[model samples]
Target: MPMSEQRYLVAARKYRPQLFRELVAQEHVTETLKNALRLDRIGHAYLFSGPRGVGKTTAARLLAKAINCQTPLDQREDGAEPCRRCEACLAFEEGRSLNVLEIDAASNNRVEDVRELRETVRIPPQGARKKVYIIDEVHMLSNAAFNALLKTLEEPPPHVLFIFATTEPHKVLPTILSRCQRFDFRRIPVENIVARLREVCAAEGVEADDESLMLLARKGDGALRDALSAFDQAVSLCGTRLRYAELAQALGVVDIDLYFQVTEHVRTGNGAGMLQLVERVVGAGYDLQEFVIGLAEHVRNLLVARTLPDLSLIEAGEATRRRYAQVAEAFTEADLLRMLGLLAEAETALKQSAHPRLRLELTLLRLASLPHAVDLRRVLEQLDRLAQSAPEAPAAASSSAAADPSRGRTAGLSRLSTPTGSTTPQPAAPGSNLGSGPFGPPALQVRPSEKPGDSLAQATQSAAALMVAEAPEASFETLVSRWADVVQQIKQVRIHVGLLLEESRPLRLMHDTLELAVPGEHAERLLRNQETFLITQLHAHLSEAISIRRIRFVVQDRSVAATSAALPEEPEDPLELLRRLQQQVPALQQLIDRFGCEPLWQGN
Candidate 1:
C-alpha cells in the first residue's frame, strides 16, 4: 500500500484537543492558562498533574503552541489559541518545531539526560519567540536528574518556558515541585465525555445512538482519551454503526438488563432464577467482578430514585431513568443499601476467591433470599390502629351483660377485672353456665341466694371483685400495686420486654407521665425503645383508672425494686413448685390435664 493510503491516525490522537478551549472537563485549567496569557503573567515553569489520559500532556502541548505562535497575544482568538496558519503553529502541528521540544522523561530520566537538556535550554529559539520544553511523565526522572534540573527550572532564560506533565505529583521531589506552577486536572465527567463522543461519531461518519455513546463513555471510566480509544475500537468492530445491544455483546460488557433481572429476582425471592442468571452470565463469558460492580451501581441508582424526588442524580437516558423509577417503587431505600453492601463485599471477595463463579452464585442466591426488612414506621402505624379500636370492647361487653340479667353480675365483675385487649379467659366461679364467647370465656351465672360470706373462697373473691370495681384514680401507689399484672401481660406479648420490666420499678406517676427507675443506660435505652408499646399495654390494662400518655425510663444509680413482687413465691417442695407454675400459666395446667401428669417423688 502507498504511504498516503496507510496514514490513518487513531481516534485518540486524531481527535486530540488542539486548542485550550477544546479541552474537555478542564475549565479551571484552561481558564487559568488563558487568563495568564491574556494578562502577560505566564510563568517560567508549569506542572500539569492528574490521572492518566485527562488532557495533562495535551494541555501542555497546546500551551506550548499558543506561547510560540507568531500571532500577537491580543489578536489571537480567545487571546490563548494559536493561529494554525502561523509559521510557529504550523511547525508545532507538523511535529517539526524547533522552539517547542516535547521530551519523554520516562526514557531520558538519568542525570546525564538532564545535563544534555540544560545545555540545550541555553540555546536561543531558532525562529519562535519562546523556547518551550514539555517534559512528559516528569516523575520518572531520577533524584539526581531532578536535582540537576532544579536550578535551571527555577532560573530559566527570559525567552524559555518549562512545562512538566505527570500522573503522580507525589513521586516528584518537593523541591522540584516548588519550582513549578502546578495545575491539577480532573477526570472528565460522563456527560462531557458523551458529548465529545457524539462529535467524534459525527466527524467519523459513524451512526451511534445515545445509549451506545453513553456506554462507551462509561467504559472509559472518566478518561476522554480512553473513551475515544473505545470509540475507535467500537467503530472497528461494528463497522460504522453502533447499537447498544450489539456493542455491549461485542465488547463483552454486561447488559444493563441483566442487572435489572437480578433485582427482579431478588424482589420475587427467586433463587433459582438467580442461579440461572449466573449460569447465563458464565456461559456468555461475562466477567463476574465487572457484573458485580455494575450491579452495585444499579442498586445505588435505585436507592437514589427511591429517595430523591427526581432522577437527576442517576446518569442514564430518559428511558432507563423511567425504568429505574418504576423498579425503585417496589424496594425501600434500606433494601437497596443492603444490596449494595452485599455487592461490595462480593466484589472484594471475587478478587481473592479461587472459585469466582461459585462465589458469585452464592452471592446472588443470598440476595434473592434476603428477608424483607420490616418498616418500623408501618409497625407503629398498625399499633396506633389497634389502640384506636380498643375502647369499643368495653362498651360491647356492657351491652351483652345488660341483655342477660342472669349472667349480668358475673359479666360485669369479669369486665372490671379483665384488661382491655387481653384474650386470657377469666376464671369462673362454680358456674351455672359456661359457654364460649367471641372475646374469651363466657360469662358465668351466680346463684341468687349465694352470700359473700358463705365460704372463705367466696368471701375472698367478693372482696377482690369489690376492690377492682371501685378502684381509685391511678396514683403512684396504684401503679406499684398493678405493676405485677402489667409485667405478666407484657410477658404474654414480648417475653424479653417483660424480663426487662421485671428489673425496674415505678418511681412516680405525675399527670399522664409514668416514670420508672432502671438499673443502667443499656436497660434504659432498651426500655425506651419499647416505651410506645409499653404505653399501649398500660393503657389497655389501666385506661379506666389511669391516663398514662407517656412512660419515661431513667437510669438511676440506686437499684430498682422488682416489679413482680405481686407474683406468688415458689414453694421449696418440687410438687408444690409444679402446682404454682400450673396456676400461673394456664397452658401449663392444660398440658398437665392433657397428659394426666403426676409429680414423681424421690422414693417413687
Candidate 2:
C-alpha cells in the first residue's frame, strides 16, 4: 500500500452530519437551535442529552460551528448552517481552529481540567467572534470538577461559549445543568435510519436491498451511528453489494425466518418441530438468550399485527410486513399475548440457566403444547345459533328449571307429550347415558366427536326438557337425600356461596319453613348476603320435595352434638355408597361411567 493511497474513513465519521438539516430524526433540537441562531439568541452555556448515537454530540458540534462562522446570519442562505468556505468554518472543519475546541470529558474529568478550562475561557477568540468549547460525555466529570466549573459555566465571558453533551443528564450536577439551555434528542426511527443508510450506499456506489438495510437498522436498535457502523461492517464483508441473508450471517443475527418457524410450529402443535428449531439455533452458534429476545420481539410483532388493522407499528420490510400480517391471521390476540409472556419468562430464565439450550427447548416445547384459547365470542355465537334452532319455552317455566341437568336423576332423559296430555320419555340414543327415568332429562347427551355447534344444540334441548319437566312430589327424606345436589347447583352459580353452604348443616325442617345451623357468625353473615339466591336455588331443586316459605340460619356451638346424627349414616363400603348414589341420582352412574371415576372410601 502506497502512503499516497486514499485512506478509508468509516461511515460513522465519513457521513457525520455537518449541517443542521443533515442531522437525522432530530428536528426538535435542530429547529430550536436554528431559530435561536436566526434571532441572534446564542446562549453562553448549552446542554444536549439523549440516548447514544442519536445526534447529541453532532448537534453540539454543528451549533458550535454555526455560532462561530464568519458568515453573517442574514447573508447565509440556510441562516443556521455555517458557510464551509469561510475561514472560521474551514478551520473548525479541518480541526485546527484555536477558537473552537472539542474535548473528551471522559478522559480529562478532574478538578485540574476544569481549572485549565476556566483559564482558557478568559482568552478572546483569535479569528472568530466566539470561542466554543464542546464537551462530550460531560457526565463523566467528577463532583470536584463539576463544582469547579459551575461558577464559570453560570457566568462565563461573553466571548466564551460552553456546549455539553451526555447520554445521561441525570448524572450531571443540578447546579451545572441549571446554567445551560437544555435540548433533549430523540431516538431515530427505523425508517429514518434506513433512508439514511440508502443515501450512504448511493454515495459510496454500494448496492444494498431494502431487507439488508432494514436488518442493519434493526440491528442498530434506534441509533443512527450503530446502524451506520453495521452498514460499514456489511460492506466490508460483502464487498460492493449487500443482501439480507449474507449480511445477517456475517453479523451473527438470528434470521427472522427462524422466529416465524417457531410460531408455525406452535400453530401446528408440533413439539418435534420446536425441538428441531432449537437444535438448528444451537448449531448455528446463536446465543440462546439473544435468540429468546428475538423471538420475544417476533411475538410482539405478531401481537401488534393481530390487534391493529395496519402494520404501522412494525418496522420490517414490505415483504416481512406481509408475512407478519399473514401469520397473524392464524393466531388470536390472546394466544399471541400468552406466547409473548412465555417468551419473556424464558428470556429471564435463559440469563440464569446453566443449560440454556435445554431451557430454550423446554420453553419452545411449552409454547407448542399451549392449548388454543377458547374464544368467548365464538362460544356465544354458537349458543345463539343453537337457541335460534330450538323451540322457545315459557320464561316462567324456564326460570323454575335447574340450570345444570347433569347433577339430577333426570340427567340425560328427554321427554315428549302426547296429544292425550300424557308425557312419554324419548328413546335413548345407542351408547348414550340418556334413557327413560323417573325424572325428566337434566341435559342432552353429547358425544366427543360432535362439533361445538352440535354440543350447544344438545345443551339447548336439555334446557328445554328441564323447563317443561314436571316436578315430582317427595317427603323430607327426599330433600335430605338431595341436599348434595342442591349444594352442587349453588356451586355452579357462585362457588363461594356453595363452599359456605357446604360448611353448614340442616338443623330441622318445619311445615313450610326450614332452619339451618352454621358454625360461626361470619358464615351466617356471608350466607345471609346470598339468602335470596340460596332460596331460589333451593326452590328450583327441592320444589316438589318441600314447600318451605322461609328459612332461618343459626350459629351452632362447637360443643353441640354432630349434625350427622340427624341425617342417615352413609354406607361404609365405597361400592355400597356409589350404588346408593346411583339409585338416588341415575345421572351419577352415567357420569362415573363416562369419566371412569373410581370410588375411594376413608376409614374412621
Candidate 3:
C-alpha cells in the first residue's frame, strides 16, 4: 500500500551499531563475545548489565545474531561476527527472524510468562544453530516468575540460548544469576560518541560544528543512544547547518563558556561578576538547580583536569580542554578540593531548596569569595615543632633577666607605639607567668572603663588614705608600683594619652601630687591636657587607690633638642598641640614632611 512512499528513520535507529566493531566503548563485551564464538565456546545463557541506553540491549541482540548467523564458517576461527548479507542476518535485520525473540520483561514479568517461555524453550530451531531469547530489563520479573524460570535457565534445551539485559543486575535472582555468564557494559566516552556522531553526520551530509557535537555528546551522559537522540533533535531544529548557540538553545543547556567564566570569576575573587553571571542565567529562564548541578560538574572537570595528566578524561571540545588546562593551573590541588567540596555541598542543598535561585546565588558568591584553604597538616606540623622548641627557650631567657628574689624588680611600663616609630612591649602584669618574649603576641591587659567621669578618681583618694592608715605600705610607693596598670587603663580611653605617658616616668611621688619628667615639652603638653582622663582610668585600674592631686609634667634632659620651656602655664592651644606632637613623634614629623599633613579639628 505504501510502495511509493518512504519514511525517515531517526538518527538513533538509522545509525544503530550493527557490528561488534561499531559498538562504542563496548570492546570488552564485543571481544569476549567474539572470542567465545571463535572458540565455539558460546554459553547457554548470558546476562548483560549496565546503565540505560549504554548498549546492554544492543550487545544482547548482537550476540544473538552472531550465534545464529548462516555464515558461521566464514568467521569460524577468529573475528566472529554476523555477516549481514547472509540469510539469518537479513532475517534479523528485517525483523522476521522466528529464531530470535526479544522480550521486554518489564511488560511480561509474570509466572505465566515464565511458563510460556519455558514451553517455547522446549522447541528446537528450524534453520539457525539455536533459538535466541533476549529478555530486556530482566530484573523487572517478579520473584515467582524468576523462581519459575530458574530450572529451565539452569539446564535449558541445547538449541535455546537465553540472553538477559538489565540496568540493575542485583535485582536478578541469585539462582538465575548463577546460570548466566554476566557481561557488564561501560559508558561510552565523549570522544567515542563524538567520533561516531561525526561519521553519522558525514554519511547524512549534515554540517555541524565540533562544539555543537560536543554539547550533544555531553548531554547524553555517556549513552550513545541518548547522544544520537540529542543529535537528531539538534539536526531537526537547526536544519543540519548546526551552530553551537542553536544547539545550546535547543537543549536548554548552559554553555561551557559560562562555566569557565564562572571559574575565572572564582579564581579572580570577583563575587560581583559571579552574581551578575547568575542574574543573566536567571534572566535567561534556565533552571537554577540545573545550573548549580552543571557548575558542580564544571568544578569537578577542573579538579580532574588539574590533577590528572591524561586529557582524555575530560569530556569537551579541544578548545574547552585547552581552556581547562590553562585555567586549572591557577588553582592548586587543595583549592580544587575545596571548590569541589563547596560545590558538592551546594548541590546537595540545592536539591531540596524551595528558593533555588537565591540558594544558587549565595553558593556562587561563597565560592567566588572562598580563599585557598591553608594546608592544616603543614600548619599543625609547624606548630608541633614550635611547641617542641618552646620549653628550651625560657631556660635560655631567664638567665638574661632577674636571678633571685632580691632582684625580682618589675620592668618599666612600655607603650604599644613610641616616638621612635617602633612598638615597645608592655610590661607583664603582676603575678603573670608569661615573661617577655619575641614569639608570642602582645598580651592584652584589662583596662579601665571608658564611661566619661572623674567620680572614680575622687573616690580613690579617700580610699587610699584609709588603706594607708591601716597598712603604711599603701602610700605614694603603691601608686608608682601599679603605674603600668594605670597606663594600660588610660590606653582604653585614648591610645595617644597612654603613649604620651610611656615617654615619661614617676620623678617624685609626694603625699598627693606626682611629678613626671618627659624628654620633650610636647609630651608634657599632652599629659597635662589628659590628666583628669588618666587619673580616672588609674583610679579604676589600681588595686590600692592612691590619690594624685596633679600630674606635674616637666621636660627632662634627654637626647633631643629642646625647643621651648617645659611648662607654659596655659591650657595648650590646639595648633600648639599639633606642633608639639609632630616634634615628639618621628612618624608624625615624617607624615607632615612627606604628605603635607596638618591637623583639622572641629569644635562644638
In terms of TM-score, which candidate is strongest? 2
What is the TM-score ranking, best to worst?
A: 2, 1, 3
State the lDDT of candidate 1 residue by residue for 1-604, as single tens digits: 9887898999999999898889999999999999988888999999999999899989999888888888997788987788888988888999888888889999999999999999998899998788999999999999999999989999999999999999999999999989899999999888999999999888989999889998999989999989998988898899998999999999999999999999999887789899999999999998889999989999999999999988977888778999999999888777788898999999999999999999999999989877544433332343335334433333454466577767523334344445466443333343222222211232222344754333222322333343333232354566788899989999889876776677688987654678898765656877899988998998898776677878888877422223234445853677766676556444445456757987665844
How do the residues 380-446 of candidate 2 rate in per-residue lDDT, one tens digit apiece? Answer: 3444565565456434224434565443322222221221254443433322322222112223445
lDDT of each: 0.79, 0.78, 0.73
TM-score of each: 0.67, 0.68, 0.62
Alpha-carbon deviation at 341 in model 2, angstroms: 0.9
Flag regions of model 1 displaced more than 4 Å: 1-6, 383-604
Pairs in steric clash, model 1: none
Best by lDDT: 1
- Residue 320 of candidate 3: its Cα lDDT? 80
